[model samples]
Target: MGMKDKFQDQAGQRQQQANDKTGESREKAGQRSSQQRERSSQQRDRARQDIDDTRDEMEDRFNQDYDA
Candidate 1:
């Protein structure tokens, strides 16, 4: 092959490798974001449950005071 053709082939190979690496990095990033979202959702659920429990306790105390 000519010098120009050899250079073109090498450039194409390098481009393909760069593209593959980028795809892999993007996949890993997506997975990490999904995990973070799940963790945040779990935390929000726990916080809501705590608030509901506190409200129930407060209502009970208020009812007791009113009855007395």
Candidate 2:
């Protein structure tokens, strides 16, 4: 595959892995105490934000590469 396709594939894989980790974290946090649960919830939000940022960066890179 070309560099663009390779980058797209890697981005998709990273997104899927992030989603899986977030789901697992949420499931485990369900059994935590109130304070711990709150902490885990915050962690989940951070993870989501990280995923969004990565996705946006990947899209920007992909666009730049393809537009060239």
Candidate 3:
């Protein structure tokens, strides 16, 4: 091939490689974000559950003391 053609081919290959790397990086970032969101949701749910349990325990103690 001519020099010009060879140069063009190399440039095209480099562009494709860059595009592929960009795509992979984006995919990994998306996955990490999704995982973080899921963990946050779980933590919130657990905190709510703990609050409910504590409230119930306090109510039970008050009721028993009043009865006695």
Candidate 4:
């Protein structure tokens, strides 16, 4: 192959490598974002459950006091 053709081939290979890396990075970032969202959702659910449990316990105590 001529020198010009060889140079173009090498440039094309480098461009392809860069594109592959970019795609992999984007996939990894998406996975991390999804995991973070899931964790936040779980935390909110737990907080709501805790609040409901506390409210029920307090109501039970108040009823007992009134009964006695």
Q: Which of the two, 2 or 4, has more TM-score?
A: 4
Encode model 4's per-residue lDDT on 1-68: one tens digit a residue. 99999999999999999999999999999999999999999999999999999999999999999999
Kindly give the stretch of ten consecutive residues in candidate 3 with the minimal lDDT sum. 59-68
Across residues 1-68, which tens digit of lDDT does each residue of candidate 3 receive? 99999999999999999999999999999999999999999999999999999999999999999999
Ranking by TM-score: 3, 4, 1, 2
lDDT of candidate 2 over 1-68, digit per residue (tens): 89999999999999999999999999777766677878999999999999999999999999999999
Candidate 2: lDDT over CA atoms?
A: 0.94
Off by over 4 Å in 2: 1-32
> Each model's TM-score, in the order given?
0.76, 0.51, 0.90, 0.89
TM-score of 3: 0.90
Instruction: Write one digit per residue (lDDT tens) for candidate 1, span 23-47.
Output: 9999999999999999999999999
User: How many residue pairs collide in each prediction?
Assistant: 0, 0, 0, 0
Give the lDDT of residue 8 in candidate 2.
Answer: 98
Give the RMSD in angstroms, all C-alphas superposed, for model 1.
Answer: 1.8
Error of 3 at 8 (Å): 1.4
Q: For each candidate, C-alpha RMSD in Å? A: 1.8, 28.4, 1.0, 1.0
Cα lDDT, all candidates: 1.00, 0.94, 1.00, 1.00
Is 2 or 4 the stronger prediction by lDDT? 4
In angstroms, the error of model 4 at 20 is 0.5
Pairs in steric clash, model 2: none
Q: Give candidate 2's error at residue 19 in angstroms.
A: 45
